[model samples]
Target: MGRWGPDARGRLEAAALELYTERGYEQTTVAEIAGRAGLTERTFFRHFADKREVLFGGSTRLQDLVVGAVERAPDTPAPLEAVVRGLEEAGAFFQQNVGRLRRRQAVIDANAELQARELSKFAALASALRGALLRRGVADPAAGLTAEAGIVVFKTAFERWLGETGQRDWSSLLRESLDDLKAVVAGDEAQADPP
Candidate 1:
């Protein structure tokens, strides 16, 4: 590849993930990742601040997607429903990139720092969602609660989706997780099954 190659960022991410999987995250260096991608360390830095950013570079985009979905949703739905609508949009995004997400999750699962960063990303997403809710005229505690609950639904569904070997999709898992949350909230004993 040329020095100023197209898709340098993508090539760097794929190379980083491959190296992280083979040599472990801490063991992989930015130089090695760039070399694997046939690019320079400067090129990697231009695309990402550090090696960790390879796994996290899409966070801002994801937050925008979820928040934008909530902002664009019709105002008629309840706060939680509006949040779910946002999550559904995110689900579509994840569904289209399930393979990369699964690989990313595996990398995160293997490292403490990456796990903390993952949690931090979720917190940011919740905060953004809360802001979106507030802008929609939802009250303080309700907005906060709905945003947190939406994150829980998303996390649970995503974990299940990652663990599954079947053909189930992200949106279906999100809906199932949301239903389970509702059942537990309503104290519907028969409806809430143990997972």
Candidate 2:
């Protein structure tokens, strides 16, 4: 065995995504990922627990980024604004990784298990966001709803970004999605039945 290099993890991730896309997630193996990356299987284990982790591994870091942002947000911002601030912070995770994300989404969408994991990750993030809001003095229901709303906005923005061809900032997409959510909510008041 040779000394592990700094790029081993990144190489493994790239190789894993490539293999997962080319061979189908279920067909890809850890050894294949390691071989494609020019690393050993041991190196792959050092970076990820299994093939699936290669796709969903970043969830923890992303959740931390968003939660930290929410905790640090100023008191002046409204609950939704604070949540958006958190999402904007988390958006940085996908800033220049749009293509990679698109590939990942495709792989996840093609697999039922991966799709379930994706949803679980989103649920975990929403729960974390709710906890962060609660820590910031937001009461129940409001904190929970605000957190869920932020996740909705983030997911919608991410989908829109994934479909785009021209290069665009991820944060900008998030902001636009947030605006769209606001508009939809505001327009809901007009649905009242005639008296």
Candidate 3:
């Protein structure tokens, strides 16, 4: 109870993911998760507001990382580049917990409620990124567009990283996805040009 208190939250998170994967999200309960973690329901509540919170808890930290990154980014950097830097910072969380990320994604993919929550999280992140960009001196429409596009890049890279077990890292996948987006946009521009 003394030293383990520091690690209880992590244990509860791991136990929750395992239970959610094994029993399905809706079927799993906080009591069961606490039991699996060898902690009490009170301890679980102390760590997470509820069961859904376990999967979405890190979102606040992720958002903070992104916003801080954008604020710290050089003013001369392109809006998209700034967005990428912010997202890359946030993506570090996924890199550190790939297994939990994969299992969490699978659980979310299997449930409509969880899927809705995931989308809401993404939307909120995009909005936050947009605001961050605007604070960085980027104009309207452009800031919004860049932020939304960043979400797409982040999501695509995240899914690709989770789907495979290769040695490729999250930052690499994010850069590759951003590059792919640039290529696609450039191709569209070339096609629109009068040749």
| Candidate that scores best on TM-score | 1
By the lDDT metric, which is better: model 2 or model 3? 2
Clashes of each: 0, 0, 0
The runs of at least 3 residues in candidate 2 whose Cα sits more than 4 Å from the true structure, single-residue gaps closed, are 1-3, 187-195
**lDDT (CA) per prediction:** 0.89, 0.88, 0.87
Q: What local lDDT score does residue 11 receive in model 3, on the 0 to 100 scale? A: 87
* Each prediction's RMSD to truth: 2.4, 3.3, 3.7
What is the overall TM-score of model 3 with all chains considered together?
0.88
Q: Write the residue-wise lDDT of candidate 2 on 1-195 in tens digits.
A: 342878787788899999888989999999999999998898789889889988877788899888999999999898989998888875656866878888989999999999999999999999999999999999999999999999999999889988988577777888999988988888853556878
Ranking by TM-score: 1, 2, 3
Residue-by-residue lDDT tens digits, candidate 3, 1-195? 532578898888899999988888899999999999899998888888889989987787888888889989988889999888888886557767877887888898998988888899999999999999889889999999999999999898888899878688778899999988888978853457566
C-alpha positional error of residue 105 in candidate 3 after TM-score superposition, expressed in Å? 0.9
Pairs that collide, model 1:
none
- Per-residue error for 1 in candidate 1, Å, reads 5.3
- TM-score of model number 1: 0.92
